[model samples]
Target: MAKRENIGLSRELRQTENRAEEEAWQTLRLLRKEGWPVRRQHQIGPYIVDFAITKARLVIEVDGGIHREQEVAARDVEREGVLRADGWNVLRVSAQFARHGDHLIEMVRAEIKRCCPLTLHPSPQGERGT
Candidate 1:
């Protein structure tokens, strides 16, 4: 539960991500390149989320088939509740849906826009303007 342990666990999770997570990560990487400060296997409080946009207080979870089980679903609900209580918006994407990288990007973009629209805009000279 310590910060050091969370960092180690996050590193392991990043290295051993499932296929769906990998697909989502690829799309998230694109978002990062576009100036969205996205992080993978990011830790939030005591939980390690699949992806997080810290500035937007958003956490994105790619739910696999195992999440369909009743027990896992219940736990997920509890987790989401805790995150929501802490002012973090949770977005759950099915593993099947994550396979579509374009759709995943769009979903994340919409969530970010809805929660925290980017303040910076590009100027005509390719510089960032507030």
Candidate 2:
């Protein structure tokens, strides 16, 4: 019961986060064609990720200006600590994915290839495997 409530509250917070991270992920999603699985506003237990590829050990965090503030920064650092302990490497990007488009996709692809090359597959004939 308590866990369900926690999950509900966490989802609500994630909804808020989605509005904040909108721009960053639209650009980032292109990496999916490149073979990295991208999940938008994904939840892990109580924490919600802005973008994550679990098997790749990569997490893309889109930081709005609000995250730069001292209090929020501290919390984010703590959040990173917890995530790191769980074996996910974090990458922070700006809010441009939604604004500009597809820029972060290549960046995230490079990071995943660098961090977890074993999971990458070569795309053929300009199509990603379904």
Candidate 3:
């Protein structure tokens, strides 16, 4: 269950978030249908990630125009470093990717696979099972 404050904050963010954010959210919903188990505006540690797959320890960030600014870019770099040090895989995507199409899901899936490869189980016959 989410805390009341975080729930309220997320609601407020949803209402005020830019079009890119809203669109990215829709894409994330589609990814969920594909079994990614991602959450929007999820809080992790001291910051809020645009989307997170806790079980996978993946954090997704959607960068808008403001992200291009020097200060924001620097902050983002620092934040990502912290997350990485904490053993979280951070994937950053441009909001423009959302405007174009649903390719974001594929990209995220690939990143997940790269960051956390699935361990194969052994078959009864001593073969590897995918």
TM-score, cand. 1 vs. native? 0.87
Quote each prediction's TM-score: 0.87, 0.73, 0.79
**Tell me, what's the RMSD of every candidate?**
4.3, 4.7, 6.9
Model 1 Cα RMSD, 1 decimal? 4.3
Whole-model alpha-carbon lDDT for candidate 2: 0.69
lDDT agreement with native, every candidate: 0.85, 0.69, 0.75
Number of backbone collisions per candidate, in order? 0, 2, 0
Candidate 1: regions farther than 4 A off: 118-130
lDDT of 2 by residue, 21-59 (tens): 665655666666665557766666567777787667678
lDDT-best of 2 and 3 = 3
Evaluation by TM-score, superior candidate among 1 and 2 = 1
Error of 3 at 20 (Å): 1.2
Question: Which is the better candidate, 2 or 3, if ranked by TM-score?
Answer: 3
How well is each residue in 48-123 modelled by candidate 3, as lDDT tens digits? 7888876568888889888999999999999999999999999888888865545887787778778767822212
TM-score attained by model 2: 0.73
Measured with C-alpha atoms, the lDDT of residue 77 in candidate 1 is 99
- Which one is best on lDDT? 1
* Residue 99, model 2, lDDT: 53
